[model samples]
Target: MSTPSPTMPPWPAESDHASGWSLVRAAAAAAEAAAAANRPARYALVAATGLLRELAPEEEGGLLAWEPGTGWRCLLPPQDCRQAVADLYLPLCAAHAARPITVAHLGQSLDGFIATGGGDSYYVTGPANILHLHRLRALCDAVVVGAETVLTDNPRLTARLATGPNPLRVVLDPSRRLPATHHVFSDGAASTVRACLAPNAAFTPGAADLVVAERGGRLDLADLVRQLRARGCSRIFIEGGGVTVSAFLQAGLLDRLQVAIASLLIGEGRPALMLPGREPLAHCVRPAARLFRMGEDILYDCDLAASTAAPAAAAPNGQSLQRLF
Candidate 1:
């Protein structure tokens, strides 16, 4: 329910209305052109709006306008543009229509990761990225990590910014990596799910609701996706170490890769993207990609931008799907 702008000139002729792919294309073309030029798409929609002028419905109305990132939105009764993008993404993402998931990587040094080192592995990315990441978290429906990560790092697994309900916290404990005595079980009464290897394992009050099940070989991956989707999780964020990163990449299930490289890379510290074994790059993972920089590190945002040749899936220590989400 939006307030209609009385000042809006009525939509044009019936001949002008874009009801099918034609109209969608027009809107998308307009949006894309405008965004590319760093200009507003307002004028484009205005031009398209005239198509229905012929209809001149007794109650003239219909149209929506707003920037995607910035929520400056408005409606004139009948038309709503805010919902257009998702629709657009659907067709645009037909082959890759998994959902607009993003993996936010917080690279750390040997000293510590995310302000958290061996002794003090508190936080990895700084305030800015942390803020941005929280915003991302709020935008998503779920957050994930692997089990070993839980053993080592007792993360609250909660979105602390961009307030709203926190994303559901998920753990991929393939082998029941998290003991019933783990902190995740003791933390606030937050919504959490632990995917374990033993499907019928008895649960303790602390970790009673764990999703314990043995994933069948290559099928474990499918089960993971199905479980999350069943939870109504459309957008996922994987934020963790290397193993998971390599897993998703190798599986070719990884949709997007967003890695933030800190200015100070502990040259001698841990390696990022743990795919295991020194395989020849020619036979390893490949993805089509791009880069952006925030603060000191560069953000490598890849959309299957790596090599077409898949890498041999290897689960190394600290390497878990937790990183990809």
Candidate 2:
């Protein structure tokens, strides 16, 4: 696949689209530059996700959508930002000073759909989107999903197509309540880790690398990050339901936001994210973002609080769930 050029505007009829091809070119350039670093996964997720955001419809031939409830999928879009971010680029962009972790905050349409939010979970997104996300998994050190998500979706969060090691399985469960018989627990796709608050609580058929975050009887996001890093986790991806996504955003653990906004909107069940109800949504370290054109939906790419002096001076929000990423 030839590299998508950055000199051209990706879409045709949307003057509302406010960005240039520089971002797209920068993403590929970043990936290529980092590949020389020879770190675990090349680019930082921030740069990789940038590629996804800048992906113009022109780059990908077209977009393909599959049936709901299907596992394996393929894409035939004109050019896919998702494919660039996860598949060929992100892995080559991984850095190691404070090694980077690529975590994603994603959710389906309101009615539990990814493609067209209604009654479709499996085939809600176009084939390109599915394949693109799969690439992100391929380059990650860990893929996190909330217990609630596991119980509801029962998805096998491992890379299937590309040949390589599967990322470590990390479940963000403050409560320890997964059954040993559960699909994720028994899948053997990757090393399973239950990041829970409960003290060594029992899992039906327990998995290894149990990370306990008991900060005053609650799960500590900071501690969780520390442990993950120690275990050689340079890039992490968090795919979630509303609550989990909200927590990551609130804790400021997310380095990037890769959102696929479908042309159609659903006004019901679960919203995109359950952001904290704090009256003031304005924080000094607000995030910066860029938008990319996908088939019918738009991909919002954001860079969280990743400035040079950010993490050091920042203090955890008093009510942990009331902060921003």
Candidate 3:
């Protein structure tokens, strides 16, 4: 979808005009009516006529719904809506509903570099994408990153730019090399999880809860996922420094992948994704991607699971081997 117009307001604004106030009152009334009827109501306010009218069944658009405690909420049609704002919320809601959905996101340059060779990745994308990341963190139950990201960026990983509770911070440090002085550890704004390969006896986490899931001196990604699931993290957002993201993708654990490409080109730097596979072109992943613009950056959302080839035929035993795609 095209980018939202620059002149459009971030949200509906209150104005001294009577028509604006009437629209607000109509919306409130519609929400209450929907709540009383135990169903959502759809209405559109015509600016020229200054009237709020119920949408017909054939009409194709989003609606404003009302919940008892929560006033009014926008309900957009996932497949029908062309609004750029819908691009952000629809995927997020879909992930939230799934059983432990995992999404990996990265902001890279035109040349596919996530950071400079020196590891200076600050402002790789525009300010809008940074806010978009915050929105993702707000929606997810947990946000994960690698030890190198923690050391290099020292990000707070909180939802400061968005409206919602901050998700739990997860640091994958197989060697426990990250220090306790990082902003994610010392910020105290959100709960943190430190997953390492070493046993509890070998190391102590600084300010975050410690989780040791080691198998052959490596942090088991599947085990880590189970731990997060046990903690009621239904949706996990993996924000990274290459290796961590690569590990998840290699494991075929990611449900969705969103890559935001910036306008500038960083000739040499850290790559965004690095899956090691020597499969032929036909066997390679070719997820159906959709594009959206977030300020100057172009966001590509890929559905990994759906885009993979279908499962092979079952064996003579009437059992099919489960595939991870």
Candidate 4:
């Protein structure tokens, strides 16, 4: 990837002696500037943490820092401001520290259904989770979904409720079945990309820019990611319709996965994820997860890479659920 622009905002100066609320403000300012410039906030936060240490040695642990040996490490205690700082910086930090962070998100009912039998899913989770998804879109460079989701939901896929700029909307439509009249296609709020298996003569171009990456009549997701990265979309958010999310999970391309589980149950409907079955329980994929209460819903934030390396532990909310293998 090309170097970020020199015109991008610089980190807080050490000489400023920022502390307490000022430190928080500085970190927030740096994050906002990075987002505005379309640059990774992690780099700026790294510099900001150094300044934080210089300003207030006692508060050094609170500022998000990156260690070469252990990756992103945060020593902050539980506090509202600290949590807020972490909420803003952690995603960017994780994205920048990794090769390319691909997070898949899903909002489903308690029984793991994403929609009703007829595909009528107005809101599975609460408003808080919806806002959280929008925030995730704001953090990511691109937001992706399957063409089936586009046809079923007709979502606008914009960062409307969030503060940051809208992400590039990506649709994986191997067969080019999605209509040009889809809201995502006609919406000019953000740039759109339509990745298909090949250039079809029958398909008419619309607001979306078309890209073809075919491999045995299938859209090569790895190639698609490379193309997106080439276009400066390093971090991707997969907002899915089951199959798309499952494909990425089975391919081991997803770094993080967030699922919002609502209180209600849809007894019969679309399943959230569909992976191949393993004969033995030990052979199943088990990711380390943390749970949080978002309004009436419970949010599961999982770290796929950490699951293999660390033992499963109870979440901060003192609830533990078996990994959805």
1-325 in candidate 3: lDDT tens per residue? 4343332213221232223334443443343244455544566767676445667768866354444433355563433232345334444443322234798999999998899988999889988788779877877889999998988888999999765679899999776677788887777899887887654553334455556666667788888988888787877999997888888988888988999998888887988888777567668777766556566777888888668553324443353542211
Q: Which order, best to worst by TM-score?
A: 4, 3, 2, 1
* TM-score comparison, 1 vs 3, better candidate: 3
**How does candidate 4 score on lDDT?**
0.67
Query: What is the alpha-carbon lDDT for the whole of candidate 3?
Result: 0.69
lDDT of 2 at 69: 23
RMSD of each: 14.4, 13.2, 10.8, 10.1
List candidate 1 stretches off by more than 4 Å: 1-120, 180-183, 200-202, 206-219, 267-270, 276-286, 305-325
TM-score of each: 0.57, 0.62, 0.71, 0.75
Residue 234, candidate 2: alpha-carbon lDDT: 68
Specify the highest-TM-score model's number.
Answer: 4
Please give the ranking of all candidate structures by lDDT, highest first, separated by commas: 3, 4, 2, 1
Task: Score candidate 4 by TM-score against the native.
Answer: 0.75
Which scores better on TM-score, 1 or 4?
4
Q: Candidate 2's residue-wise lDDT over 119-196, tens digit each?
A: 235644555456546656766677887887777677778777543357788887666676666667887867788887
For model 2, give the 10-residue run with minimal summed lDDT: 63-72
**Best lDDT goes to which candidate?**
3
